[model samples]
Target: LVTVNLTANTDLNSAEEFEQLVIRESGGAVVRLKDVADVVLGAEDYDSEVRFSGQKAVFMGIWVLPNANALDVLSGVRTELEEINRDLPAGLEGGIGYDSTVYIRDSIDEVLKTLAETLLIVVAVIFLFMGSLRAVVVPIAAIPLSIIGAFFLMQMAGFTVNLLTLLAIVLCVGIVVDDAIVMVENIERHLSEGMKPFDAAIKGARELVGPVISMTITLAVVYAPIGFQGGLTGALFREFAFTLAGAVLVSGIVALTVSPVMCAKMLKPGMEDHGFARLVNRGFSRLRDIYGRALDAVLAARPAAYFVWAVIALLCIPMFRMSPSELAPSEDQGIIFGIVDAPANATVEETARYAEAANDIFFSEPETDFSFQLTQPSSGFSGMRLKPWSERERTPNEILPGLAAKLDRIAGISVRAVTPPSLPGGGNFPVEFIIASTAEPEQILEIARTLQQKAAASGMFAFPPIIDTKIDQPEAEFLIDRDMVASLGLNLRQVGEDISAMVGGNYVNRFNIGGRSYKVIPQIQRAGRLNPDQLESIYVTGPDGRLMPLGAVATMKQSAQPRSLNRFQQLNAVKLSGVAIRPL
Candidate 1:
């Protein structure tokens, strides 16, 4: 085949040109292309359709830039979506279908609050034990320097301030303060021995250098194995482990470099025993005496201490057996999606109606910020975002049961309300069951439906389990009579070509008019090909060069067939998935 490029011109700019273009001269009369074929404007045919919640809809995904801040990106998207909703035509709506950052922001805020409270507690404990404001100041100074130094290293390593990294920083708050505490306590001991402030600071730091280095290295080593974990576990925790190790290492450096200097400048030659300091000292001294007496008693009753230890060890078996285990905890992000599936042969318009009805249930709730629906032929999906936690009394979890009940009341469609997965890339449901077999599709579907019913009846899941199997779609089958074709002087190949060209249309040729090439497809008019009955009236060129009716040579029948087939491990399979009602 040879290919050629041609520039489009004004004469053939529109569909009307197909009707005007000359096909050939027949019997010395001009025969336009329309004389033998139909030319009309219609939408391009689509082969693939998207369905969510068993409803027809289009899929859209939003991506954040590599260097962009997630919180900032989320804020911008929310603002823009709000603006878009305002400008949308009446009855149109928009909403976020799935947002990963919602949980990220919430987790970070809670972690930060915990870090602040922890810092306050640590400072108070230091002051109470040391009984000197100067001694307390030394450890407090180390906190900010170490944390800020971790941030600097994070920036250098191109790490973003995400949930895992922030968690690492929170843990470092406790671990990093240990080095400073050891240094200040040693220096205070020297001060109590009547040494000068400068001499005590130098000697105290020198004496603890070995121990400080050992402690820092030991903590870092404990986290090092986490960084080396294999597969997905490694990918998720490596950043967290390394960030914590870096913070501890930096804290040790700060203690060695700046801690002694601060102590020398801030401390007085002798400890002051007045006001809060004297009271705190007395309280700590009494605690030490009580601890000392308790320790001596334990040492003297060695057999009783061993018996108590054995009892504690025996109790651990029940505790271990009773505790729950899970891969990841569930998260509520104030959003949920309802998947809607109609019968396989349903139209997009029908799916849209079902989706809109489901959306009405969500919109009726006071907690809903907004609701949106999407529909494709045979299936549809709806999503809604709830008001923030501060504004709403109930969470998505609380709202879900009511919403599911309401959705169940809707007729002609199956609906499932699913929460977003806890971990990124995890499946939508907490558990998925795959039934693989070499059996026929009908048998596989029967098994799947039975499993779904049993699962729903068990009351162990949030809703009825979804059976992932295709429905039978309506199809037309043409049974050609070879005897009738031969009697009518009709060739089967010619009849097929003519029918295909007239009904389904054919790209017979291409033309150019405006620097772009356009295909020329000619088919029977919509009025002539609107229904299966019209197939009888279609004309086919027989071998005798005479026009023959298609109905005379063939018959059409309607039946149902699977719309799609899915396989797993080279075997036909049906899948079932649902969220567990109780934590597993």
Candidate 2:
């Protein structure tokens, strides 16, 4: 608030101004804020805290705008972070914790490289067979245009450029150009029979239109079931199936229309058989003669061929048994989460110290870009992001073994570096089991430890199996005497309240200071509450208004107990989890 007068004016808009304002006045004296209470600048109390790399820090998340390009958003965010880093103080830094664009870019780039290599192979094979450069160009030109045309259909179907769709396009590089190749081959056949280029193209396309449509429909029907599938399979492959079907349909159209027209315009009456083409033609001719001889021999000795095929089929049984199978292949996502656990009785600060030691080791690695640490009372987690795939030689999977080794050496903490599962509704590990028991927690713990040890000794797991149970937290039990309390004129409630106030702080009331209200809580000083022996000094009031020592009414003993209890289907359960050395 601001105060104004005709001759004088004062601005009192800041908290300091309000704090310094006088609240009471007397003769030759005044009661300002300093007279009644202490006023010092400090940070406001927070309900939650965040720690990174074992140091207290703030965490922030950036979300891409709806419908915005992911690469563009990532670029903008990276640029802003660079600028922010420049302005930060020395020894302070900022870095990306997670970036989806890395995986998306890598997947697309690999698929594109595969697509290009496939195109080259297809072109080379076509040239080797036809021995004509002009005929090869027809299929090469049809491939791109047909694939691009599918994007229009994809747009209409509300699909975006993603891994599945790009994969479909890559696959279409071969399938989409099939019809065009057939058309060109037939046109070449007609040309060899002395027909004109235009007439040959028209006759070739007319004869193959029915067959091309039939082939396209057959391929489309194969993928139609994929699009209609339910559950996870359908959700994953719907885009892939539709994209391939659309590309095949477009190619069929191009074969009937653009292919014939282009062939008529570009293809010549005959190909020159000389130089490289002549050499390739000679090689192909020799190969064809050998194939013809082998086919005739196979037909004459069908029993021998059948016997060889039968032996090969029998061998396939053992081959299949030896092959590894998995629901999803593991992908290196350029990040790994290290879950660190301290003893159950450890404080948050102690856990943070352990996390810091682990983080130091992580940062020392040349491949690590940055790391974020989260510490709780007895557990902590470190999320370490590696350098980009293009920048680093080793992937997260390749580096996990070394990192886990270093983290395992950190004292007072157990750390496990885990790559998140590719699929949802599962733990990070490949194998997980639950041990349910109706017995006591001690028996359950013993059984779980025995099973974990057996599993570890089997040498079938990448890491020792971990049991999800904790029973190391420190506790104290107080045995109270009701008769002694009643005789001392002190009730149980009074004793309870006194103990609570001493340990947990007693909330008195609320009061205002500088226009802000605050709760007032007072408790016993640190030295008075440090040991169980000190409990004897804590006094409770009796009905006679006399103080009675708490030790006279209760006996205290130390013990250890489980931090938490877990149940499965109304029965206590211990969860065991580990990664398998081989897929199961």
Candidate 3:
């Protein structure tokens, strides 16, 4: 229901406001967007995302409501967006476009009609060979019942009536009834040889049932692996397997139960066999005679046949040299892309601005599709994710080059931009590393430098040097003497409380407006707040109710600290990861 570009730039506050406004205006029918989906705002996601020629870019896609008609809802959404685009903010302009998944079912339905026509042609061929319309009717009657049975089972199993599954059923339209036709034909053959209709119906099926059942079971067993062994592709293909299994199983049962009963009543006396089957039977009978004679001729010339076999084996050796071995299938999922990046030590506001700038191009042209940014992924250094979409526009492979040219013009970037890669599953990467450590910051800088050198020397990863490293941020590190604080009659907790009030501030409660809540923040006035050099001058109350200068027992100076710290297995550590292409 909700998706994001890994590198999009929309203000988190603004995206939150827009989401809340929509939910509020809907009169709570769509009560909790976050409950049903993750309405995250951040940079576009990159796992399975595309980048414009290694520049940050993103594309988004939306799934239609389960119960709603896709075309109707999408059309209404398009209309609403067109109206909204008339009043965009300055230097901000974009247009919405369409994607085929919105209307693909309708197209599939059109294809199904052609498939149905082909099926009818196949049925007509069956009648022509049997020389009786009754033969065609016998098998065709099982088609609808078989299809209905599949639908009922799919519904019971909580499966959506999707294209991949339906294509299997469409494919069965011609083949499903073939077994019944064969059983009925064999019964007609028995009748021509002077057997009673009831006896022929029963005996003919009794003779053929073993082979018919074995063939049907073979098909079901072949397709059975899809249901058990498949991974993500299995989820898509399993339904096809099950649907075909169901149709084949149902048609087999119908062939044994219904087709025989129908044959007894419908098949006429003295019906003639004609068409390709008749020609096949006669020609094949003569070919058997020819083959027997040829076998004797070949046995007498066995030396020449062995010479031909040796020559063919010699030719096949070179074929192995031309064959390719692959580890995984190459992917091509339309043309859209996604991207997520962050500037060095960027505040959330600055990150949002960069993301919005990147998102601007995605939303600019009318032909451009959809764009998304996870503007506020989470608190504490989590940047945004952006994704954009296009319809008639070029694919990610085509547009990335041009998009890279455009993004290079932007300033203040910390990482070399990269495009999203194609993936089988449409999703964003979850792991993002922000390298920070507490070893005097300068020591941490050295650690990062060593890591980059080692990784580059490994000759496995081809990306640019690790770039999250940066100059340490200035902080006030105070060393308070324990005995001096006791002499002042002030405990450490009291000093901590006073410092928290002066710096970290306090959260005052909330105000409710029309059932909505907003946080109220309280803090010292900006001009009165303590800076690193001014920390020494700040005064704190002692236990005897006397004012004492903070400089007396605690020394303060400008020192560096990491923006964040990470722990691995309860020990401080730094994490680094990136995509690996063809490795040495």
Candidate 4:
């Protein structure tokens, strides 16, 4: 059993910590993480693509674990925050956000408050124009019926009640009541002139219906273009278009159908006069009086007005140039990552150990939450996984860099660095280029060295610890004399078993405790696998039933070679990777 305890200064991300916790609980029986690999502390390798309000921030997505309920986990996370908030680190605060569904449900209460406020505003506007109880009540009735009807339509059209939709509702404060205003004002004027209430209402509504319907249709058409934009922009604004269009249409219908009926019921001959009504009437009379005066002055100064208009138009042209175009506004969600590689021929166990140490660095610093995952290259003569993948830690910023440095110490691993991920619709970094060549490794190395020098002198990248090229490996030989083995009545297969047993170690059955199982690996006693002298000193059974020394059948020699090599177009190549401080 391998035990890993994280301590301060261990800088690690949430992903790495999650990975380590998984390793500790699994007990290596289902699979020995170590047998497969090592663990260590390192820097944040992945870049955070998004930023919030110009400050660098990353998203740490949280999902309910299997067999766990979302709301329950959400509650737990909230509790964790309360605990953390009691003593938060400087410059940081924790907040939670939900998906669209939950957001709408929570915001619906606020929408009701807005709805009430809108009603109050519409009442004030009506009192300003028409000045009586009959006038104020008519337009106010149109607001709720229009909105409720809009809500039903939005539901049918699959729209969520969100910011844009709510904005559309707010916009309706002026628009939806206009038709009601026109109908009510016309009928009241007829009543003042001594017409019967019912007759005045019918005549007024008939006179205004054409213009009201035309205006509503025109406004709806103006917003129709938004629905066709497509993708993210269209998806966001579609609800606004839908709700606003529905509200206006409903308001128009109510003006024609319901307003006339209500006016007939409410209007009466010689109704009681009130002080507020007189004030409203006097205000409109003054407005018309002022407008007549302004009209005469504007006509006399038409040339000056035109000159001012031209100047304003010229000023607006320059202002347009200052506006910025972007895909979307950025948001902050704190997150971090740790990337590292291990030494050649290093066992999985060692790799996991290295990762755990890195995780310790993160937990110690108490950065954001973190998690990690590990993958390995396939077994082969090339000593490279066709994938050449890795294990990574997802953590908060406080622990990321320190964690990355810890992983860099592992064997066979190189080119470890921390970087933020690319932005949406933007190119991502850490992209590797496998430059293949027919030239020898020496030549490849030389070319790599030159490229590195050019890159360094160019001042194009600001990140430190840049490595231009990496050699695959040092070469070695395993000599087996088939003839000598056959003469002794021995087989090559047996020799392979002896070597495999001596090195790879055989796996027996498993042992279980607390419902968890671990694999039992049996290894032959060996002085050292890397020492040729020790290989010669080992013993194996021969065909003659006599123990034969390994030295009698083979010779060992050293040579330079790559543990892993990649090719492009049948040419030998090595990959060069590094973080660019400024995005290219």
Candidate 5:
């Protein structure tokens, strides 16, 4: 037997000491660890990797704080990026990998376009129906005035103009015009009854005050429930609901206060003698006569009318019960979100390979503008930003099923393709159920597997549900032989320490350089420890300080272990999450 003496404790402070470590001394010409492997200092693991626009790039996610404006935050990020781009080192650069705010800005532009179109349409419709520029002008003036008042109320309530509030403003155009139109028509009627324009305006406003108040109350109440709703609905719609209600209330007040004066100034005696007015008045007269006769017939059949009204009222319940419900409707946000789930034993590099396969599928689509990815050891999230809505013939919703099918075909991985949520704080998957128990996590994992298998058999999901927690990580255990170790004149402690030092990747201590501390770790290079079979070649110091193969006294046994264990509510819990094939 050969003996190698340990004289003093050695502290490896740099790569050179680790490289010069002695694995064994076979002859007068010594053998060293460097003969079989290389030593290097680097990160413990490359767990976080990002790919942007199909190129290797870094990714950073920015989340908005509560009560903060997302657009403003995005703007600041963009400005900072410009400065960062300027200072970037040669041939290296940084910028936004993907911005969710792109969709928000695009949607805002579409809503603004719709707002302008609605304004033009409103003006055209009023001109066609009333057949008087003067009548159209009066109501058109009220539209802007009421909107101004609504803006004031919104400011007072600490509301900002957003997508939903902009939509409320678009809708308010019609409601504000409604009050003005009513005032104009009623005044014209009084004028035709042989009153002066000034007298008719005053009389019409006084007579319709009650009707206008009731109209305002009814329209305002329609959106009151949405604003008062308890959770997500209320939070999302409070601005929309109150904006609309406040606009209508302002329109009513404006009509009672300002529209009557404008009507008097713009009206004249027998304005119906002008364009389309005479024909419209004639048509209305005939329709009114017919309506009078129909009313008399309905009064004669009061019993049947009562029965018909009651039947219609009862039909609402069944219609409502049969309707499908969901938290929010699907929208084409111009991007597709994807989730990559690899085997529990998979490494970062393995998962990245799977992610690449999925990314190719995403990038292959005709509408794809760019693709981005964030990778982890066993799971990741990725996405593709599509071209503009006007540019793409198919929306993200239309393309999702086929894309998902293609992603599922990738070997050795599960890829889920979905559209991003239209609203904040919404679930990414359509189906999610939590299973909690006081039993051990292993027990809960078994129960979760059964549920997932049953769910897959039922064909409810686009694919089988994925459990959040898994007990499937691979492990390597050395089955040390106590008798053999004793026969070799070695104890288990020496063998264990030798194995741990060589492959455990534990840091021995720290060394300082350039005012910063770096961990000093000594381990067999990655190439030497690539697989469990290589562990047999590792040498440990025996009781007499002679080097011997670890295989002589210990054997490695392969097994599986839990990837993670989590506790929820003081109980082990597992979540089953999936995107359903059909809306549930």
Candidate 6:
């Protein structure tokens, strides 16, 4: 088969050029594609729309790889955004409207601020408790050393500096301080007891060495199980547990190795003879007397202690059983998502109006900083980014119920406000129960409805379960008569293609605008195809190039059918989704 190429140009960059596409040529009467169809460029799906703060908008999201750092990835994206925004055309703007990393950054900043304030408070408290600058210095040295060592341990464990790990660091401040302060007070006590600085230091260090080791081991043992346990709990808290355990171990080491040495060098005879030291000493002695008396009284009634301990132990099981349990406690991520359920047959415009109502409900809360909405023909979603955590006292979870109440008042649309998943991988809804079987879709749907009703009756869900595999969408089927089509000398393929061209919204070819290739989809005007009656006006090619109305070859059948055919693992599936009133 030999072929000769006449024109090298295959890229039709405009509708005018595509309209000149050759269809047929006979007796010098060439028929172009424009004669049979209209070529226009438009959005891929007219049913999907997005808005930011009530304006048409497009969004782009940047995600970090699992092994990569989120902060670093967002840092790079933010830098790139600056350049992109600088080059945007007039009357247009581009920037990050939403960033999950902002909450993380703010959380980290808040933790650091608290850490600084705590350190200052720790210094003052230690001075007042000991009435000795020497004691304060020893702890100041030991605390940082322990924390830095904990950071080293984190590095060895390949743990990132995250919320949980930082929280461990903060908690270590108290644990490490206890070990350091105990060692300091022991050496200081020796100094006041008339022991020489060097001898007191050695004796104090040796005396408490066993106690320090025991304390460190006890602390480490408490967190060790948490680090090694199975499941999401272990994964989330492994770094936290290990970091805290490491910090305690490091604090123990520092207390024995550094605190004693510093105490020997810094402490001197008559150090506690000062007036302030005597006053503080007197107050502690009286407090110690009161504690000693209380202890003696408790010991005098020995059976009471045993009875109290027995009662406490017996209460543990019931208390634990009755406690509210959730995957994780709700957190303030500064955003709330409003899920919008539109009628199955609602148009995109109708969905948009529903979404606007949802957005209004979201913004009705004074804490809302900004709002966004997205809509499709059958569903919609909206979100409100609350003010910064510092500005808003209530977390997103706290505000969700109120917003949901307001949203419930909107007629027709069902809007459910939800906080971001407390834990990762929870998906959009709390309850995503799926019913799958090899049975027919109708059977699966019936089973699903039964389950959904049961779930609603249990009073566990915030709303009635919404089944996904609903057979309620109205459809108009074009029932073609193959016999009539054949007798009319009409090609079945041409007939189907002609009908598809008129209303299918399928792309035929690509046209370029600037350097971008756009799809050329030829569909009847929206006004002309608004109902089933409009389908009759569409024409198809017949014998001898005659144009025949589609109504002559096909009949319209109105029926209710499933909006979609859903399968899971090759089994018919129906998903019932809802929010749980109680935590799962």
On TM-score, the candidate that comes out on top is 6
| RMSD per model, one decimal | 5.1, 6.0, 13.5, 14.4, 6.2, 3.3
Query: RMSD of model 3, in Å?
Result: 13.5
- TM-scores for candidates 1 onward, in order: 0.83, 0.79, 0.58, 0.51, 0.87, 0.91
What does candidate 6's lDDT look like per residue over 203-283, in tens digits? 999999999999999999998789998788888999999999999999999999999999889877887778687788889
Superposed Cα deviation of residue 359, candidate 6 (Å)? 3.0
Could you give the candidate ranking by lDDT, starting with the highest? Answer: 5, 6, 1, 2, 4, 3
Question: Which residues of candidate 5, in runs, are more than 4 Å off?
Answer: 1-41, 457-459, 478-501, 508-518, 536-557
Kindly provide the TM-score of model 6 when superposed on the true structure, using C-alpha atoms: 0.91
Instruction: Residues 148-222, candidate 4: write the lDDT tens digits.
Output: 888888889877666678878887767888888888878888888888999999889888978988988998888
Write down the worst ten-residue block by lDDT for model 2.
Answer: 40-49
Q: How far is 11's C-alpha from truth in model 1 (Å)?
A: 5.7
C-alpha root-mean-square deviation, candidate 5: 6.2
Clashing pairs in 5: none
Candidate 2 residue pairs that clash: none
> Between 1 and 3, whose TM-score is larger?
1
Worst 10 contiguous positions by lDDT, candidate 3? 377-386
Task: List the global CA lDDT of all models.
Answer: 0.80, 0.80, 0.61, 0.61, 0.85, 0.85
How far is 274's C-alpha from truth in model 1 (Å)?
2.4
For model 6, the superposed segments whose C-alpha errors exceed 4 Å read 1-10, 20-38, 390-398, 436-439, 450-460, 489-491, 565-572, 581-584
Q: Give the least accurate 10-residue stretch of model 1, judged by summed lDDT.
A: 46-55
Query: What would the TM-score be for candidate 5 when compared with the true structure?
Result: 0.87
Please, what are the lDDT tens digits per residue for candidate 2 over residues 1-584?
99876664364434465468797777978888656555434333322345664467877877787678888889999999999999999988887667778877887888888888988998888777767777778888888898888898899898888888989988888898889989987887797799999999999998998999999999989976898898878887888899999999999998889989888988876463655666776887799999999999999999999999999999999999999987687887888888877887666667777777888988878898878876776776678888877788988778888888898899888888887666543555678888888987778989889988988899877577877887888887667799998887778888888788766655565555678775555456556876667877777776587777777889888888887788989999888888765577
State the lDDT of candidate 5 residue by residue for 1-584, as single tens digits: 99998687565667777678887665677777677766666776567678987688877788899889988999999999889989998998877756778888888998999989989999999888888888889999988998999999999999998899999999999888888889999999999899988899999999999999999999999987799998888999999999999999999999898989988888998899866888877877899999999999999999999999999999999998988776677788888888888887777888888788888898789999889999898788898889988888999878988898899889967878877667765454667788889888888888999999999998867778978897778888999999998887878888888999898878877865456688766787667788888999888887688788888888889988877777778788888888665556
Model 4 — TM-score against the truth? Answer: 0.51
